[model samples]
Target: MAAFTTGEAVALDLPIARVPTRATAFILDLVVQIGLALVLGLIATLMIALMGADSAWIDVAVTTVIVGTLVGYPVVCETLMRGRTVGKLVLGLRVVRTDGGPIDFRHALTRGLTGAIVDFWMLGGFGAIAVITSMCSPNARRVGDVLAGTVVIYGQKQLPAPALAVPPPWLANWVVQLDLSGIPEDLALAMRQYETRFRTLTPAAQVGLGQSLVITVCTRLGVAPPGNFPAMQIIGAVIAERQRRALTPPYSNPELLGLTPAALAAVRG
Candidate 1:
């Protein structure tokens, strides 16, 4: 099973698409692309003939159309379709980030541009470099995947999400102001685990671990403890706030308020 860890520190076991499957998908996509190019070429040829254009111009237009179609097809499909091309949709494969997030235009553009070179253009369009690279890489990453920081995986949904911690209504305003960047990933994971299973812990055990976690996180965020709030509440608030920040894009309408992001989220919450 391939373990795909998300940016939120959640790990999912997904099937990695192997070379054979990838090759099949690519061949399917190639056939469609070639068909599109041919149709476009036919149209161009008809137009050129009707206009009595020179042979040199016709040659240039055909070459330009084929090249543009080859490159633009993947870019448009992957970007607009969220990594699913006609071939990938048929094969149930999708290109995602290494972290399992949805890829944007930049990733699609990089993959398409590089794929045209290492995967198709060089060595008589045999994809020798891509095949060798896929064989060598554990994730079957070709030149485009490597450069774009993406992986092609089985596109079906994985395991259900875990229950997340909720911030208390009262402390939401105060907790949002903390700088959470210093909190380590493992520590954050531990906090999530603690939040999920806290009900099972004995009262004494809960107090001890909860206090310790609150102290550690508070120290990391460079904030003093809220006197009246429970330790678990503090921990939960930070985790929830961090999650909200992740979902909130920078320079969004939330920023229009004079309030900081954490504070704005607190207000929204």
Candidate 2:
């Protein structure tokens, strides 16, 4: 259960979703990065050659470049290599503070090198640690995230709608038909409960809750839950309440359209 680090690596209340970047894709991201690095290295070499320093000074310059690469190479590599850097991109991830913040160079470098102890040495040992810890911790942090203060998220660039599954058969039927008037009031209540359980929680937590709700909601609603369904569907059913409740009088509580996220969070508190 990780918190969302909106832009920087601060503690987040929400967890960014994970897109599995397994061995094959990870290798691909690496190959792409290495290719980029080679181009950069060549440019560095060319600049040095064009300078045309004296033979003695040339040696010093080259030596300086080598040392600079030692410190700077990883920094460059980490950022360019993995969408964000080595440790993050490798795991199909990126770094952010628990407070919903973007990670800076210092944090990225620290996490990249320090996390190497796990990610590099045992070859996937660090990857394994990151995956497991993300599952175990409240903020879904990896070793580097814990030490450097960051969060590993999947899509740093896009903010997708949060989705949940439709547990009850009627709910599922309502989703596809776009007709909610026929649904019973009981199922509506079920949908509301279903939304609360999955939507507010982190993806890591939702993973399990999602599985359970699929079964429970189906049994009660006299329908089979979809195996491996998206979370958005559940939200859709709840959202369908707008259409379902349209039949009711407009004597209306503007709040009846649905629960605002703030209200939901308040209730969660």
Candidate 3:
């Protein structure tokens, strides 16, 4: 799996295209480009024959066709298709930046120029340099991809959603009654982190951290910690209570909502 980490520190698991698949795509693209060149050359020849064009014009047209077929084709396709050429689309592959963002025109241009100069055309037109580079690189990136800051990946896979901790059934009513708004942002963040990863911790570590967090939260809320309640339950309840309060509308009179003045004042204060 190729993990693309964003600036936000979120890691995404995406499949990287292997050498065999990439080579196949490249072969297909090469065949298409060759066909395009043949057609363009034929058209240019016919135009020259009909117009009685000079030798200089013929040389210029041949150079243009060769350069355009080798370099301009990939650049145009990648830019218009947003990193997807015909071959890439056929193989369910896409070129993207290391951060998993879409590649831009400059990236496409660099890749195309580098690929033509060193990877394919320069190395006996056998793509020997590209193959060796991809084999040697950790992520199977060729010289073009390295120079362009891009990578090829299987673009169709979806990332799974993270499972969040929920409040325990026994503490549901108790949590709704408490003034959760008094909890500090840092403490709340700690509770959330603990709740999310408590199951992964060892028994001793879980107990130690959960107890510390429960004590801290209870102190911040100006309430006595319940000894019988599970630590995970307490943490989940606090998280749920905060979310609930955020979604709940404020009442005009606390007494009407069965909340004491002190309870309401705790949140306001």
Query: Best lDDT goes to which candidate?
Result: 1
lDDT of 1 by residue, 1-269 (tens): 47876544466887888889988998999999988888888888888989899989888887778677877899999998878899998999988888676777899999998888777665426787788889899898898999999999988763333334579998899887778779985688678767767899999979999999998888888888987677788888988887667546662433111233344445556
**Sorted on lDDT, highest at the top, how do the candidates line up?**
1, 3, 2
Q: How would you encode candidate 3's per-residue C-alpha lDDT over 1-269 as one tens digit per residue?
A: 77875322236888899799999999889888989999999999999999899999999889989988999899999988878888988999988877665677999999999998988886626798898999998888999999998999986753222222367888887777888767865576577677766778999989999998888888888888765888888888877666545434662433212222344455445
Cα-lDDT of candidate 3: 0.77
Residue 12 accuracy (lDDT) in model 3: 82
Q: How many steric overlaps are in each model, in order?
A: 0, 30, 0
TM-score ranking of the models:
1, 3, 2
Task: Give candidate 2 regions above 4 Å deviation.
Answer: 1-13, 16-19, 22-28, 44-94, 116-118, 121-140, 155-269
Q: After superposition, how far is residue 98 of candidate 1 from its true place, in Å?
A: 0.2
Report the lDDT of model 3 for residue 65.
94
Candidate number achieving the greatest TM-score relative to the actual structure: 1
> Which RMSD values do the candidates have, in order?
8.1, 17.2, 15.0
TM agreement with the true structure for every prediction: 0.65, 0.36, 0.58
| Winner of 1 and 3 under lDDT | 1
